[model samples]
Target: MAKIKVVLIEDSVVALEILQRLINSSEEVEVVGTALDGASGLQVIEQNQPDVICTDLQMPGMDGLEFTKEVMKRFPRPVLVVSNAVQPSDVDNIYNLMQAGALDFFPKPTSGISTDYERLKSALVTKIKVLASKRVS
Candidate 1:
């Protein structure tokens, strides 16, 4: 089976590495490109044309909501939001992200202590595969 190509957009270097490792652990997923900010994220997405995009909701420039809107407007691909923010407002942001055309959202493990990597990995892989199967229209 062809692996699901994924582009990761995150501002934190550490979180980005963690996410990459988790996603690559799945046999069905591949990390084709990565970026620390939304502008570069758009560039990489355009260049790679990956099957899905996983992005952080909070970033230095052009947050995930804005990125999702632009990607939906220009590229129109499946977007899965992965963010560290878990507060009420952050949770509410997921709705906005969806409104801007995100396919789903995954909250990062709080406190930076991930004891359930396997479960998270499984869920992310499953979401990626499912989203990749859906047509934008």
Candidate 2:
């Protein structure tokens, strides 16, 4: 079986590291590459051609929604927007990202793999695996 390649984009170093580890532990998914901002993430996707994208909504240069719109125009891969910040004011941003072709969103874990680590890992693995099917040619 082929592994699902996932390109993760996040600004927080801690969140980025944790998410990398979490996703890498899954047998179905592999962390192909990572980026600190949306622009870099988009470039990485264009270069690497990953199977899925898990990005933070708030990032420098482009941000997640802007990146999603640009990505949809060209790549059109499955994008899962996972963020640590979840405020009511972000509803429109989230909605726009989805409308722009994002696949789904999940509230990032508040703690560093402490608050229900296994559950989060399982959900991520399951969700990304399903999304991978849609990305493959």
Candidate 3:
């Protein structure tokens, strides 16, 4: 099978680096591009036409929600929201993102989140793989 092409939109430098590492390490996923803001995320999306977009909940120049909405409206690709603000049970944002055409979401690692990332890696990879298999059209 082909590797999943992924575009990431995250503002934090540390988190972005970590995510890039994780994504690049996976044989099934590739870091096609990264954007620090939502508008640029859209531009990267248009350019790469990735299989999935992994974006943060909060960002400048726009936010994950608005970017997801616009992306779905125009490009119509699968979106997987990687957010730090969401609690395990509080999946309101996930639903909201899904409503905006995102396929699903994963709780992102925030400050001092090394342990969280190690624990969440398998589930995150699995979800991204599954979502990437679906056709947005």
Candidate 4:
């Protein structure tokens, strides 16, 4: 089967690199494109036409909420938000992102390059694959 293509939108260079590496490690998924901010993310999306979108909640030009809305209006892809703001305690943030059209959420690993990060790889890839199968319009 063809690997699922994914586009990543994150402002943090470290986080972006880590996410790309983690997602690429999965044989079932691949990071097709990446952008530092939501504006550039849209362009990448247009070019790649990925199966799923992984985005950070906070960005310089356009935040994930606004980005998700634009993406739904323009491209219409399953968007999985990977951000620290989506923690269970932040119900409002999570609800808003979902309301804006995000299909799912994954809390950004805070431990940097550590065991916790490594352990999250499977979960992250699972989320991506699940989202890839979702129908978003």
Candidate 5:
């Protein structure tokens, strides 16, 4: 089967690198593109035509909420928001992202990347695969 193509939108370099490594380690998913901010993310999405998008909620220039709206307006791909702000405690942020067209949310790992690698990788890859199968309009 073809790997699920994913585009990551995150402003943190370290987080981006870790996410890329984790997602790429999965045989069923691939990181096709990445961008530091929402504006650039839009460009990358246009170029990649990814099956799913994983993005941070807080980013410079344009936030994930706006990015999700724009993406739904333009490409209409399923978006999975990965962000610290999307924690269950932050109900408003989660609601806003979902209202903006995000299909799912995953909280950013609070501990060291390596410590959470195995579990995070499994969850992230599963989410990407599931989202890839979604039909967003």
Candidate 6:
């Protein structure tokens, strides 16, 4: 099976490393590019033209909501919001992100690393695969 190309936009260094490791462990997916902030992420997305984008909602600049909007307006690719900002109050923000064109969401593990690491990996991998399939179609 050809691997799904993924671009990850995350501000936290540790989180980015962890996510890259976890996602790359899946033979069906590959982390093709990464950016520490949404602005840089946007440039990366444009340059790489990834199959899907996995991004965080909170950052120093551009934030995921605005980035998603711009991405949809320009690139129009499948986007998955992977962030720690999915609290109750953030529900509206999540809705806005979806409205801006994000296709899915993944809650950032509160404990830094997930206790059920395999489950998280499986879920993320599954979502990426599903989105990749949709993109292909």
Candidate 6: tens digits of C-alpha lDDT, residues 1-137: 77899999999888888889889999999999999998898899989999999999998879999988888888888998988786667889888987888888888754556688888899999999888766511
User: Which one wins by lDDT: 3 or 6?
Assistant: 6
Q: Locate the minimum summed-lDDT window of 10 residues in model 4.
A: 109-118
Clashing pairs in 4: none
Cα shift from native, residue 128, model 3 (Å) = 0.9
Off by over 4 Å in 3: 89-91, 111-118
| TM-score for each model | 0.91, 0.90, 0.89, 0.96, 0.96, 0.91
List CA RMSD, all candidates. 1.8, 2.2, 1.8, 1.1, 1.0, 2.0
lDDT of 5: 0.92
Error of 3 at 72 (Å): 0.2
Tell me how many residue pairs clash in candidate 5.
Answer: 0
In terms of TM-score, how similar is model 2 to the real structure? 0.90
Clashing residue pairs, candidate 5?
A: none
| Candidate 2: worst-modelled 10 consecutive residues by lDDT | 84-93
lDDT of 3 at 84: 74
- By lDDT rank, best first, the candidates go 4, 5, 1, 6, 3, 2
Report the lDDT tens digits of candidate 4 across residue range 1-137.
Answer: 99999999999998888898899988999999999999999999999999999999999889999999999999999999999898899999888998999999998865455766657998999999998889988
* C-alpha local distance difference test of each model: 0.87, 0.84, 0.84, 0.92, 0.92, 0.87
Alpha-carbon shift of residue 95 in model 1 (angstroms) = 1.9
